[model samples]
Target: MGEKHRSRWVETLVLLVRNPMAVASSLVLLVLVIVGVFGDVLAPYGYNEQFVGDQLESPSGSHWFGTDDFGRDVFSRVLLGAEVSLRVGAVAVGISLVAGVLIGLLAGYYGRWIDDALMRFMDMLFAFPALLMAIAVLAILGRGETNAMVAIGIVYTPIFARVTRASVLTVREEVFIRASRASGAGDFRIIFRHVLPNAAPPIIVQTTISLAFAILSEAALSFIGLGTQPPDPSWGRMLSEGRGFIEQAWWMALFPGLAIFVTVLAFNVLGDALRDVLDPRQRSALSGKGAAR
Candidate 1:
């Protein structure tokens, strides 16, 4: 089982790497992760340290990205902000993934009343636009990074639930699932052992896509003063601060905006590549063409 899983992953990796866009996106994402992890070490100056004399300095040999209105190093702040953005995405996604998967598995396996009840609840959440719902949640929960994370997770949960339930519904109809039930497997055993593994690919692709959204959501929240309070470096907050200085100091907003754009694009591209590589239809089509040739 382990060997088969490993081989499957290897095959997916091979297919993913074969796409130039995927390979490039993967490298960009890897660099972002490295920067996020070692940002403090990589940054030349402290994120919040003020250089009053050099305030609002344009990009030069000394300041790669320039200084902000507060004389803080924009480059350092952007580097540190990478850590915050990545953390928000990861934590929010982790919350949604676990809750969504469990709800989806139960709803798909049980069906009937259980499915109706759970899906209706998810539907209620879906009624609101994601950003609006996140904003409403943040409004009620007060303001902070933790609150933003929770709000983002809540906002995205329905998306994951819907995706997971769809995947589970198909997987539950598979022969192995029926066999597992016939062999006297318990509900937990059948759901975890048979249903989850088969349903995982789409869920993983959804997760990658969700991460991009999560990052965007966090940025939006922070831009509105609902996330990552002052003194903390956040891309959204930086953009908010830079709005006034756009005429004089474009670097203040440009660097952080570019960071957000690149990071989100990388995740989106990676997600699309994953879907192409992992979807059985794509694989079957490729195999059919190969055989015909």
Candidate 2:
């Protein structure tokens, strides 16, 4: 079983490598992860260190991405901000994944009243626009990175729940699931052992997509002053601070905006690639189309 699983992963990797966009996206995400992990070491100066004579300096040989209004090194701050942005994305997605998967499993397996109840609750959450719901949650929870993470997690939970439940519903109807039940498997065993494994591909794809949204959501929250507080370098906060200086010092906004754009785009592209790679129908359709041509 382990060998088979490894072979399957190898096959997936082979397919993924054949797609240039996926390879590029994967490399970009890899670089971002490395930057996030080693941000402190990579940053030339302390994120908050001020250069008295270098306030609002334009990009040059000395000041790579330029300095901000407070004489802080924008490059250093952007590098450090990668850690904060990635942390928010990961933690928030982790929260949503756990709650969403469990809720979806129970709802899908049990069906009837349980499904109705849980789905209705998810619907209540889904009724609000994600950003608005996140804002409302932040407003009630008060302001901070932790609060923002929780809010974003809560905001995204319904989306994952819906996706997981949809995947589970299809998997539950499979022959293996029925056979497991006929063979005297317990509800927990059937759900986890049979249904979940089959349903996981879509969930995995959604997770990558959700990470991009989570990062974007955190940035939006920070831009509006509900996320990472001052003295901490956040890409969103940097954008907010740099807005006023857009006329004179474009680098302040440009660098952070570019960081956000590139990271989000990489995740999105990777997710799309994974969706194509994981879906047998998509693969077969492409193959058939190629053969016909």
Candidate 3:
């Protein structure tokens, strides 16, 4: 089993590195992480520092991106915005992943009344539009970055729950699971030790995709004054601020918007690559096709 797992991971790594899209996306994501971590060091000016004479200045040597309406460096703000976006996405996804996986495990393992009830509740949540549901939660919780994270987490929970439940249901009927049950293994042991590991691929893929959407959701919330507030540089808020002066100062909207677009695209592409790489059926099919080739 250990050898099998090792070989499986090896195959996945091989496939991932060999894929051009995956490699490129990984590099982009890597750069995003680097920027998020060292933004302060890399940025010439503070994110909120107001330049006396540079308000609405176009991209130039001192400010590669440009200056915003407040004379603050657009490059600095965009650099730091990566941290805000990534932090929100990570926390939001963490919240959903934990809650959703637990709910899914419980629902799948103890299918019947529990499954029906849990699934129905998730369905109710899923029925609402993702952004609308998030907005409603924010309305109730009041406005702020923390609240936005909570709202986004809540909105995405149903999706993760549904994905995890389907994966668990598929794993539940496997020969090894039945064998483990027959051997008097506890439910917790079987579920955690065997079931969850086997069911993780789809969940991981879902997580990556969820992160992309989470970033977008955070940006949208910030755009509407529901997320990262004043003095705190946010790409969404930057966009909101830039739209008014778009005619005269288009760089304000363009740079931050491009950041959001590129980051989301990277995550989505990585998710697609992981999905293709992680599936055993897909891996076998690829091998067969290669042999035929």
Candidate 4:
């Protein structure tokens, strides 16, 4: 029994690890996340500390990625900026996921008026452009990274709710779910133990994909001056500041923009790969392989 359980878990791990795209993306994301978590230690200079003599220096042996207009080390600032981007993205996605999952569970399990009402509410949110809704929320909440996160979270919640609701609707009717009900499983036990666990794979994939969008939204908000204030280095804000002097100092914008591009692309690719790996069909195939072996 122990060996079989361990073998099943290993097979699942193998399935996830076997996809080259997923593996690569996951590795890249891991690096970025580590950098974000430990940027202060990894960065050569403080994000806010200015180097008076090194303003706007191009990439060189000493400066690496070079210096910005404020004489801060561009490389260090970008590293620290990664922390901000990831923090915002992770926090926003987490909040949205929790809210979405709960609302979806209620809508899916209850059905009838509850389903219709919840879905219509979600549709209303879906109708509003994410950027527009986020902008409005930020405007009302005032300019700050935390507030921006709240805005992004609210903007993305509807998508998660919709996905979760659909997944739950399908899963609720499954034969195993019916058997659980017949076995006298309490509603809460059935949901927590069986329904949510089975429903989580696609939701997990969606959340990973949403991380990219969340980061992008944070960048957009910061670029518009509604995010991370002065002295707090932010990639989006850095790009905004670099726009005017792009021709004269290309490194100012290039490095930060590249960081954003690579990170977002990594998450998106990873999400797609995870979807394939965790697919129920793939899971069944891997189980068959395990049994055969």
Candidate 5:
């Protein structure tokens, strides 16, 4: 079956399942995602509803994780904020993944004018610092979650494109690929079935890492007032507002910061694990070492 065949591509999943830290982090992220997706039902209080008497209240039975300056439940806002973070992360990475992989495939596989032109364009795009590039896009487009996602996607495309192109170049010269061409397989079929399968590992790894970057970029943009605006419950805006009261209302900032940290760390760790599993060189080295021992 297609599902079973696809499952075999990730032998890394077995190794990841064995890693306690990865498992724990993955569990935490899963819980957060569930809360984010169903926050309306899971959160006890409305994200923006004010509890006048509970303003800046410390953790208590009635108000957990304390209350913000406006007496809004920090717990509720954080849950709602997760929705924004995850949405931006998923959507932005998806956009970059598609655009980057297409560009990278054409450039690396075809070579000649296509490769040179595409790579040079990527070089120019890569020159701008991510924050500045995002700012420029947001400035022209005005501010909103959708616009912010676009900005983040633009910033991340280079990462996926470069990795994909390198993988494609490597795979294109492999004997299997040469044989596929010698058999008179169409260019499209060769590229899709032979080249892409081999090229996908690095691209997938980059996608996981890019998700983290996208989340961070969204947070930064929100912090600067260019992202998910007022009462929308984004972690960056929460951190920005909480900065003024950090000494007095530390929970407001602490929880969101921790959420971002742990989420990014989980993705990075998973990416590294996937890289180890996916790389043939690494697998061969491990096998060789095992034999020697």
Candidate 6:
């Protein structure tokens, strides 16, 4: 089983590297991770350090991005902001993934009333628009980065729940699952060891895709004054602050906006590539086409 899994993973990776867009996007995400991890070392100035007279400065050799309204180095702020955005997305998704997967496992495994109750609850959450649900969660939880993370996590929970439940439902009836049940395996073992692993491909792809949305959600919350707060740099807050000086220092908005755009696009492209690589039907189709060619 371990060898088969390793070989499959290697093949999937080879397929991913063969796709130019996936390779490019993977490099972009890798750079984001590097920037997030080593931002302090890479940054020339403090994220909050003020230059006093250099407010709204354009891009120059001194500041790759520029200075914001507070004369804080935009490049430094953006570098650190990558960490903040990534943390928020990861925590939010982690929250949703844990809760959703557990709920889905129980609902799928038990079925009947548990399934009805859980799915109905998920359906109610799904009824609301994602951003609106996040806003509603924030309204109750109040503001700040922690609250924003919680709100976004709550907003995305239903999506993960639905996906997990669907995947679990499909996997639970398989021959291996029936054999496991007949072999007297505990519910926990079966769910985690066998079922969850099989159900993971779509979940993994969904997670990559979800990070893009999570980043956007965090930015939206920050833009409206409900996230990150002042003195802490956030890409969204940067955009909000830069809007007024857009004409004078377009670099303020342009660079951060581009950061958001590029990051989101990279995640999406990578997710699509993952989906294509992970799907057996897609793989067979590609192999068939290659053979015909």
lDDT of model 1 at position 237 = 95
Best by TM-score: 3
Instruction: For residue 92, give model 2's deviation from the true position in Å.
Output: 0.3
Per-model TM against the reference:
0.96, 0.96, 0.97, 0.93, 0.93, 0.96
lDDT tens digits by residue: candidate 4, 40-140:
99998898788898889998877788988888889999999999999999999999999999899889988999999998998998899999999999889
Which residue pairs show backbone clashes in model 3? none
Write the residue-wise lDDT of candidate 6 on 1-71 in tens digits.
67887888888887787789999999999999999999999889888899989987888899888898888
| Candidate 6 residue pairs in clash (backbone atoms < 3 Å) | none
Error of 6 at 160 (Å): 0.6
**Prediction-by-prediction clash tally:** 0, 0, 0, 0, 0, 0
Every candidate's CA RMSD: 1.7, 1.8, 1.2, 2.5, 2.5, 1.4
Report the poorest 10 consecutive residues by lDDT, candidate 1.
284-293
Model 5 agreement with the true structure over 1-293: per-residue lDDT tens digits? 35654775655575566557767867877887898789899888888999877789887887778899999999888888999999999998988888889899999999999999998998899999999999999999999999999988888888778988999999899998899889999889988888888788888888878887899899999999999999889999999989999999999898888878888888888777667767878755644655576
Clashing pairs in model 1?
Answer: none
By summed lDDT, the worst window of 10 consecutive residues in model 4 runs over 1-10
TM-score for candidate 6, residues paired by index: 0.96
Against the hidden true structure, what lDDT does model 6 obtain?
0.90
lDDT of 5 at 185: 97
